[model samples]
Target: MRRHQLAIVVKEKEYTRRIADYIRGSSFGDRWQVSAFTHPDACKQFVKQGYGIDLIAAETDLLRELQPELSHIPAIALVARLGEADGQFELLQFQALPLLLQGITDQFEGLCRKPVKGLAPNTNGKGALVLTVHSASGGVGKTTLALHLAGVASARGLRMLYLNLEKWNTSGLWLQPGGDAGWEGEGLSELLYAIKSGSSSHTSWLAQHRKFHPQLKCDYLYGFRNQEDRATLLPADAAGMVDSIVKSGCYDGVIVDMDDGMDELHYELLMRADRNLWIVSEERSALAKQSQMLHYGRQKYGETFGRIAACSEVVLSGINSELGNPLPAVEAALAPIALPLVREWRRGELHPVWSSSLYRAAVDRLCAYLLGESEESRIHAVG
Candidate 1:
């Protein structure tokens, strides 16, 4: 997806830093590519010669200094205070960050410009981006969110494969019985063996064994059977399963649901994945486990410890209260993608959970990050 360019011109360097850092660490980081300019002329030069910016959010004083050639450019006034004299295009510099972002979103949407076209669907040739969903604590709704993410992306016309790497296969709970021949071919074990053994027909084996879930609009393997078979999974097995699946050019993205342990297989998978969603809950024990998990990684992997952290983001699940940040001192991107506890899901029905509008909206946000947001959303989504 093409990220829109934004130019932030505020003479106060601190102001620019505050806004830029917030956006960088927020979901907006993916939507906008922001550049800070302390001097007006530099910003003006960038606007005139470089590719034009999508929006110039600057102090009124800065905007006034620009030449008339830029008079018609999309712009918003960054002010210390709000007043009637200030047009709707003006945003207060001191308002809540979310409010300021909302103001920018509103003003930008109101612009009478060409629609922002979403880029073409992710081609299989691009090789699916591996997104691993993991948690330090179990029963945290990790697989559920992973499944929703895959379903949402698939619904957006992007091909997705939902793979469960769990030892006990918790994802099987959400999946209906007598469907897709669960664990029949003992999912991916043979495929991985073929890959490690250098069998040329491994790709053919993938297509034949995997079945499509009609509702998810996504494909999934029958899954692996027995802890003994799963225990044999090696660090190199990540490439054998995920990398091989991607190489097949069969899907745009692979959503991996993994167990809680940070074993060699888990480490290899997390490090190899393009993005990682580390699900966290409000419980103190869960948070402590996550913290310990990171501390352990830093100690065991040392120097190379932060690689996985760099690509990882926290996803808050079953959060019912207004607690500030779930991962204290943890840099969250876009308010942690808060998820609601759906009561209907307790009926032991997957359809009710999938159909829940609230659940779908939250998953949509995660999907927007994975696969670009839909055309209609590009035109009007506030968040």
Candidate 2:
């Protein structure tokens, strides 16, 4: 099936270009085909020529003029502000491009009531369980924990995928060996483009592009090769990419190594995750930072913070007998699971820890907490 087509009729070329770019980078781009026109007459002519346009967005005056001709199609009127008396037209602020695009898609979907074509059907009926490992402070062994979790799950015969969403791609340093042949094809950027373009064969592209981390014992997707690539991605784009990967049914679970931040992208992924782990060190400064982050989240996100807080488990990494218990305030705010520090980890050697008794025990306990079963019992069942 073909995607729904959208027409943008605005007098400003800059607005048209910006809107086009936004749509191309968003999930809407995958679900809908878009064309921009600087004049309403051009849009009207295109429609009159029997081109299929499921939705139209134009400036207030132009939309009022095009309404009589394109009345059957849903239309959104772009406005500078919300003081318009015309309740018949959907009014959207031009400054809020993301919101405006989302509103347009929602209006079109509601009015058309038609399913989009060329999208892969959910044949598996069940998606991968998403688990995000995050920290408010960096260098707290968050990525190490995430890798160990994926490795353990894979060792238990579960298909797993690890996604490193940090600003820089550093998993290669630990997971890939020195003599191994490095990645050859496109990385995450290409896959995101294929998804945004609504390609039906995106699963094939993902399979071709995914890198295998032999030590981690799972398939992994590297982060953007360039810092500029990170800047161009929006929360919605990440959401779309994750959704497509999960829907592919190529893995039983996905472990995300999230960057240390409270940005929209991080929040979106955290909210969508089936389980979330917040890793923090035993240091006073780390706990203080975590507390401040929690406060900021509550003040900014309000009710959304409640949902995030409910699903999250705080893990205290780098804990030793010498450190004793955490501060009363920290304990009250977060009852963290204690994780012992592995000596080899500090030396930048992780493969040996997979078999080390102490390291395995800690990870097994953490896994049991996440999977809601005794480590032995779960491993036996899975194996």
Candidate 3:
């Protein structure tokens, strides 16, 4: 067993007392060194001294007021409630999980196991796969598919980065660990600017300055949580920026989500992608939108535009199509566009069922697509 030192910072004394008492009684406290902090400045100073605090726990409000820069320390926020958050602190809300210390313990375990160095190549890492999920229509489950694919790829030991390109992002809201949520104030907008005008150091900066997960093998760089943050990426030179980022070799796969329609930025990301997935409902308009999106991609990137797959085209509620019937129409519309249907993302939460082999098989297929492996390769056991 490895020993880790942690810094627990909180504004409310009562909450801190409960958490610390639980820590002292738990088996984890016996294995790791622990310290506590009541002031944000104190924790900031400790981080500045290069003494790495393996984990940080604090309240959502405290984190928002003082967004300190401790690049390596993965911070967790203890929240009393859950809802929409506003401002730069939105990133911090992810850090705000439920007040349960057990979830905190689980998070701690995962952080310790994460790879602390640069990513190494695997089947999924050999060549970068940029899969962007977007719908011209909302409630189409684009983010759900993106998260499931990322999780499946990661569980199979691939190095992946999921980037939310939409300026007004909501993926972070659902993906928060232990119900903790918060924005880290960086995204494609920052990375794009840094890559073009900034020095080579920017690449290393993005890599080393990421939050880690103990349960999965993926690192996420989140987008703006509000419309304002999305505005920061405005007036971008999409083609030049995409080309530079794609060639940088900083990540093995870059999954992005841009708004629907044939905007400059949307086409820019689609053309650069090695695998582009367009998600839509089975409704007439959704099917039409899928057609338009595919045609738009071909127009922008030419005939060899990355592989295309239509997800949730017919499964969504309110569509008149019978179950599994829309697959034919979807395939038909995509034929002329040159994008083919690879798989369907079944609706609802994507957690794998332990008893069902069919669900497991679907996950394996997703992993195959993500790893770029042939049909013959065996699926790696999920850790």
Off by over 4 Å in 1: 1-126, 178-182, 321-327, 331-335, 346-353, 370-383
lDDT of 2 by residue, 1-383 (tens): 56878888888888888877888888777877888888778888898898988888778888888878788887766666443425434445445776566556544543444322211222234566678888889999787788788888777766678887777657766666562223344777777776677665444445445667676578887566556766777888787777767765456678888889797988888887777888888788888888888888888899988888887778888887676765445522353346787666677554442545676568767776555565457551110
Lowest summed lDDT across 10 adjacent residues in model 3 is found at 84-93
Q: Count the backbone clashes (under 3 Å) in each candidate.
A: 0, 1, 20
CA shift of 233, model 2, Å: 1.6
lDDT string, candidate 3, 62-137, tens digits: 6554365764565555544322222111122223223244345544543444332223332234334466666666
Between the candidate structures 1 and 2, which one is better when assessed by lDDT? Answer: 2
lDDT of 2: 0.69
| Global lDDT of each candidate | 0.69, 0.69, 0.51
Ranking by TM-score: 2, 1, 3
Q: Candidate 3: count the clashes.
A: 20
- Tens-place lDDT per residue, model 1, 1-383, is 66778888888899778888899899878777888998888987886686778888888777777636577677777766443213324566767776677557545644532322343322222456788888889978887888888887778666678988887785655564643324555466776666677665444355445667777777788666555667777778765678777755456678898898676788888887777888877677777787788778877888665888877777777776555545464433433367777767657654432667888788777656543455347321111
Q: Against the true structure, what is every candidate's RMSD?
A: 20.1, 14.5, 11.2
Misplaced by over 4 Å in model 2 are: 1-125, 179-184, 327-336, 347-356, 379-383
Sequence-dependent TM-score of model 1 = 0.61
Best by lDDT: 2
Better model by lDDT: candidate 2 vs candidate 3 = 2
